[model samples]
Target chain A: MSLDQQPIVSRNPSPAAPPAPGADAVLVARDLSVWYGSTQALRGVSIAIPRNRITALIGPSGCGKSTLLRCFNRMNDLIPGFRMEGQLGFDGDPVAGPEVDPVTLRRRVGMVFQKPNPFPKTVYHNVAWGARINGYTGDLDELVERSLRRAALWDEVKDKLNRSGLDLSGGQQQRLCIARTLAVEPEVILMDEPCSALDPISTARVEDLMEDLKAEYTIVIVTHNMQQARRVSDMTACLMLDEARGNGHRPGVLAEFSPTDVLFTTPKDPRTEAYITGRIG
Target chain B: MSRASDALYRPRRGLRRALGAGFAGLCLAATLSGVVVLVVLLGAVLVKALALPPNPPWFAVGEQLRELAAFLSRIASSTNSPNPELAGFKAGIIGSLWLLLLVALIAIPVGVGAGLYLEEYAPAGRLRRAIQTNIANLAGVPSIVYGILGLVVFSRAFGFQALALGKMLWAGALTLSLLVLPIVVIATQEALRAVPPSLRQAALALGATRWQVIRDHVLPSALPGILTGTILALSRAIGETAPLLMVGAANSILFPPSGPSDYYTALPVEIYNFATLPREEFRSVAAGGILILLGILLSMNAVAIFLRTPTGQRAASRAIAQLGRLGWSGRRAGRSRTGLASAVVVPGPGASGPDSEVAQPTDQGGAES
Candidate 1:
């Protein structure tokens, strides 16, 4: 309830630093704890996000994986009663400081929601709108085309750019959301369960798109599927709910942070192994 | 056959069917009861307003139509009089129209602005909650109470002669506006709330300012609903007599008020005066006034209903999008304006010119928007 009385999280026996110790970290969180009106959501979630790499956060439901993803863009600020303590740095700058506007931060770090939420407008407008609102002085048509192409949705939607974005299939709509985010030219793309609503084929397309995207932009994705974490992510962070307090303070804490292959093949913590092996959540 | 299957097949289908039919019949009766009463009231008003002679109209339908046309023309041109033959609601009609326009101008923006502020901008606090609760309570307060408030506040200006509006058209208009303000505010709030939070989040995530998110996404999406709700509130205000009476509207006027400060009379006030007369012929005149008032109210409701439909909502949203594009593109180069307009202006199917190259991709195996 009080800042000084915030719950301390149990850390891994091994060092909590990610496997990529020397890699250029774009986002770094240290001793970060979050609360929503006295109900703690995340506790001491410390991790360094390497630049231009696909980092996936995988955990069971209500484990604060989404909350952690949202914190990168300051999206949790939208929620009422949301409060946080400790340091969250983006490019060596304190993100929650007064000098940094959340609007500016969001422009640099874009997000795609769990459900595909396309604007109720034409496909062309949906992509061009972000650029237009950000006061893009270049050719809007070119930007829209390039963003759609990068999302791998240009060829399918080129003939019908004038159609409503809602007219697209669930998969295409998700891709359209991606293209919309891309048009803003964000350095980091945060995806919260992007493929959970899509079929296998659409999910495969998105995974491939993610693989293509990591060569340029840093991506932080939160997914429930461990296989998705294995298939696309270069690095993975596994989180588990800390219910041991037994006082209704169920906060999520990081269990392991390692390279994707290493984390999946030989998890350091027993909880991570339990989660991956489907023994317990 | 299995024993369970035999038992299921032999269950009491007759009793179940009878019970379902009985329940459905009860629901139908409940619905028709209200409809039947409304139909009877409308029939009575129609007969009296037409002044049809008993048992003589069935064979003379053409003659009756000609007389009806004459009656309508007479009412359209003439002013109220003591004699039923010369009586009409032309002054009332014109005055009510002016009052409606004034109320719309005064109430709509203020009410809707308050609603938007309360729903979107206002912080969650005790003051905001108190304001919200007061507005909700104001909507349920009696019309006559509003009338008394209007009498003291708008007409008399609390004994300040210099500030008094003096029972003028503006005073009555202001009174009606105050009376309907709560309705409009509540309706606007409901409309704003109906817009999905996801749309706002989508816009906000794009680094749009709060105002930009509301202007570009939320407002346009809520326009149809707001329009319908506002129009319905306006209709309710138009039929209100008690408030206008307290505000000192004239029961009889030779001509409609030509300016805001001039004396005015509304349809409901004139009808009430006519209906209270001892003469039998004046009742017919009152019925005619009633018919005219009903016609106005019905048309307003029809517009509201139209705006409520999917087709109407889509058309409204498209027009808003077009307006938005024009404003947004006007600031940019004029060359791109035409290109953007061409893309947005033309509907998807069977179009030529720049949009022709863009084929319609209709069969996407998705839900219809």
Candidate 2:
């Protein structure tokens, strides 16, 4: 079977390729299609996100990478007219099943958005808000401190925990958002262009934090910056809009998914190769 | 060539400058006309209040202050005098206070709840749009119309009389609350809408339930705007006589309202009654009542402004700090160094007071798109 045809074989590794040794699948998508009303944003995209590793979705604008990331946590459900049809499994459980509450799914799979969106609250409350609502009866102060420490923001914010979260610089605010997500103790963190709004220094800090974070939490990041994918991600999935489909409202499709080194060095699809080499986006 | 170019530009520039100045002068005159009319009317009212035909000495500033003190004492004593000159607005004040309390109790929760439902939970459809349009229309409906509705629904249909709530303070309050409900809801919806979608998304991504997000983040951020709206609505409610009249607020009442289900007359209604009398002495009484009404309205507005202004919050915190210092000094005189150390170590509720009150609104205001 060719690489393009293997996606149709459900519940099996691609016959044209095989899973890398010891890379466990934490999240697996099979022919996932998403639509916002009549507009199909993603079509028949399939990829498995490995546990304890970073998976980067790299694509040009209008490629539905962010939409796919949002689908993992059912964030897309918040948008009116958003519809999805496909198999999406997290740890072998159906994510879109009626029995699986989006709220509960979101608790297990936190997301960091493109822009830094800290609550108009104190730095302390920003981190503690998630835990408090989740009925965490433990020491919230300690949890806040630990989360901030994990996000590498403790030392800078320790003196002024009562200050508003928005008082922080854009970079610090993004880290504060990360701390907020981390405080929930999610198994997976889906970041949609987390570093897109940051300066290089802050981006480096976040990238480094992601590297440290991957030992415990599976991460899926959608990035426009290909160099970021190469530097931070363990595995990379390249998606592209299918221009021939849907009469100019074409849906995004997964073109390539491989280990970061393999995909960057030897991308099987010409589109992926073109995208990586700056020939086309 | 430069002189010729300068000559060409100068006349046009001068003309533009003159036009700007003329416009500015026109605006100034327009503003001053309102201010001048207000001042003249206020002066007339003051003169009438302080110097009625027979008893100019009684309404003298010093005598008026003494009378005010006596009136306050009379209110504290809960006595009702029938004499028009000495018939202090004790009953009206009490009745208005009762009405204010009831209106707040009824309007705020219902209005805010409606606002939340409309803004957050209501789907974008014809029903929601229709409801929004109706709310806007309701806000524009005259106060007297609300009173008529209140009379029909609350007094006649509900038979509040049969239920022992006849022509009472609560009935008037209900009417006034209904009159202002749309205004409050509209204001609250606008305030809630002003909250950034990003904040809501942030909370949701953290796995917060919708209510949890609203209560913890959105409400706190929107509170200043909501409060400003509520106070403005209440101020309008306080001055409304036509609605209260329809709802059966007594033109004249002998006794102060002791409870919700008692015969009542608000300050505006009392002022209106006093103003219409054939006697000039009654005019002084009416002027006095108007002054009192203006004072209440102005003070409510002042409170709203204080809450809305960032600098006002800083000033309030400074005052609080001064009070704290006074307490600290008193403690220092009574106790030793250990007490001071304990004071420094113990984080009071006030520690987070200023920022929580001040920061959210300022940040939200700045961040609002």
Candidate 3:
């Protein structure tokens, strides 16, 4: 039987080859596959995230967009039974290896979770904890203020910096989380549906903040909202479930990777077209 | 309406409502049964402690009140005597307090540390589950079982002279510590588990190491819950007599323990000794001793409840207020006859459950779609 005709053991080429080197790619994944125990979640997938640009990973639920984002910072290490195969890179350096310290890797590639997960601590402490623990020797007060300002949060929270972060509005708490990530001075920011918990106004504000932030930091966001992927991203990667195998298990595969405008406006893979046109996910 | 809609909204309405109300009534009755038993016991203890007249106290309320006050003062101040009028639990009280201090010093650090390791560091698998199950089962093992274990392992050191601790005060303290260690561990685990996983994830994603995550976010959030659980466990320890007996607590002693090595007798052990005596006088003295022990236990448990209160200001002031109320009401009106007993029994089961005190919103809006 042909390779494609095999039930579940067959391998296929990635939907797209990884972007060539010197595309100014800061984070790159090649033929990356992930498994949680016996079940595969991500199939062979390749993509490149350019430096100083917003790269959005968009797909339906169960498509491993968040899984890919977490792999960049190795946050997937926290999940028991999570296993990844294939190369993941940060700043052109290998990241998905045992020799690398995840704590250090996470410092350089910080993340914001799907929900607004502010510490139940003072606003200032929430922003400062990362820097303090990462041993930032600079003035913490100045760093906190600068980070909050960068996240468009300083003015709203300056008066109550000592108040519990949990007291803030959901949008404000998300911004505080962004501010916290920024405080660690990471070069790459991984966001897993960062604005999904916020209202439209907050979403628009966060979108603007992302537009503003890309000049200084590379960003990779996993969003279920196709409109959001179109609105804020420079490069977009679409992931989708591969064909269901004989046993009915389907794993996520990269469907398309290109400039956001082209991917959204023009034709590409039939699956991408179907997803963009709302016929399939 | 469609048949489906009718089934969803109205089918079995009468029976369901009746069952719900019946269940609620059953729970109320179940709860009240415990409180009623506790109240009756407290009432009996109060009558015995005051040695109240059977039927003539209606007109001599003032005289009876004075006598009650005098009895309380005498019990609080005097040492144990074979003479009923002079008998008191001064040595027992002092010794129990010493045992409490030592037990807290030993148990808190060890139990909390073990809990932290199990919850945070231990790999989740068969071994962790085995240890967890064993610790849980240990919490249910009887106090006398622990007393026997203490006698063999801590006091006698299994007949090894170099390790033998003998029947020293520290031995008893160690025994009680073992008796309550599982409680402390279970409570600490529950407290640590109460801290939301999101907090840990947030900290970890910020590049904080595991230790940093726990130290910076997890520990602080879990502290109040841990304190509440530990205090309740200690209260349980304070009222234990069987373990102390097994570990060789003195039935009678002249002076309170001066140090960990000194021979000691606890309030419960002393009360048991007096209660078993043939004289009616010793029984009343035992009753007073029971009152004193209950007061301490209830106050500790009250503090535990106050700590569970989410607001810090209310926690501090309410704990102080409750402690004061317990002392004053127990002394003056004997009002603890109902209120204190019920408070003591209800919170034991309630507070030991998951840290329900902090109501974290569970909905993860849009939840990673």
Q: TM-score for every candidate vs. truth?
A: 0.91, 0.84, 0.86
Best-to-worst ranking by DockQ: 1, 3, 2
Stretches of candidate 2 exceeding 4 Å from the true structure: A1-10, A14-20, A244-247, B1-11, B53-84, B158-161, B311-369
lDDT of 2 at A131: 89
Candidate 3 lands at a TM-score of 0.86
In the range A155-218, model 1's lDDT, one tens digit per residue, is 9987678778998999999999999999999999999999999999999999999999998999
lDDT of 3 by residue, B1-369 (tens): 477666656577789999999999999999999999999999898788777333336368887667766777787678778888888888899999999999999999999999999999999999999999999999999999999999999888999988988879989999999888998999999989999989998898888889988876787778788888899989988999999998989988878788998988999999999999898888888998898898899899878877877675345433543453344333323211232122222244444322211111111111211
Candidate maximizing DockQ: 1
Each prediction's fraction of true contacts recovered: 0.48, 0.54, 0.54
Of candidates 3 and 1, the better by lDDT: 1
Would you give me the overall lDDT of model 2? 0.80
lDDT of each residue in A193-226, candidate 2, tens digit only = 9998999999999999999999999999999998
Residue B212 CA displacement from its true place in model 3, Å: 0.8
User: Clashing residue pairs, candidate 1?
Assistant: none
* RMSD in Å for all candidates: 5.8, 7.9, 12.2
Chain A TM-score of each candidate structure, as shown: 0.93, 0.94, 0.92
| Candidate 1 docking quality: incorrect, acceptable, medium or high | acceptable
lDDT at B258 for candidate 1? 91
- Backbone clash count, each prediction separately: 0, 0, 0
Compared with the true structure, what per-residue lDDT tens digits does model 1 show for residues B304-365?
A: 99999998898788777667654544455333332333454445447433322122211111
The predicted structure with the larger DockQ, 1 or 2, is 1
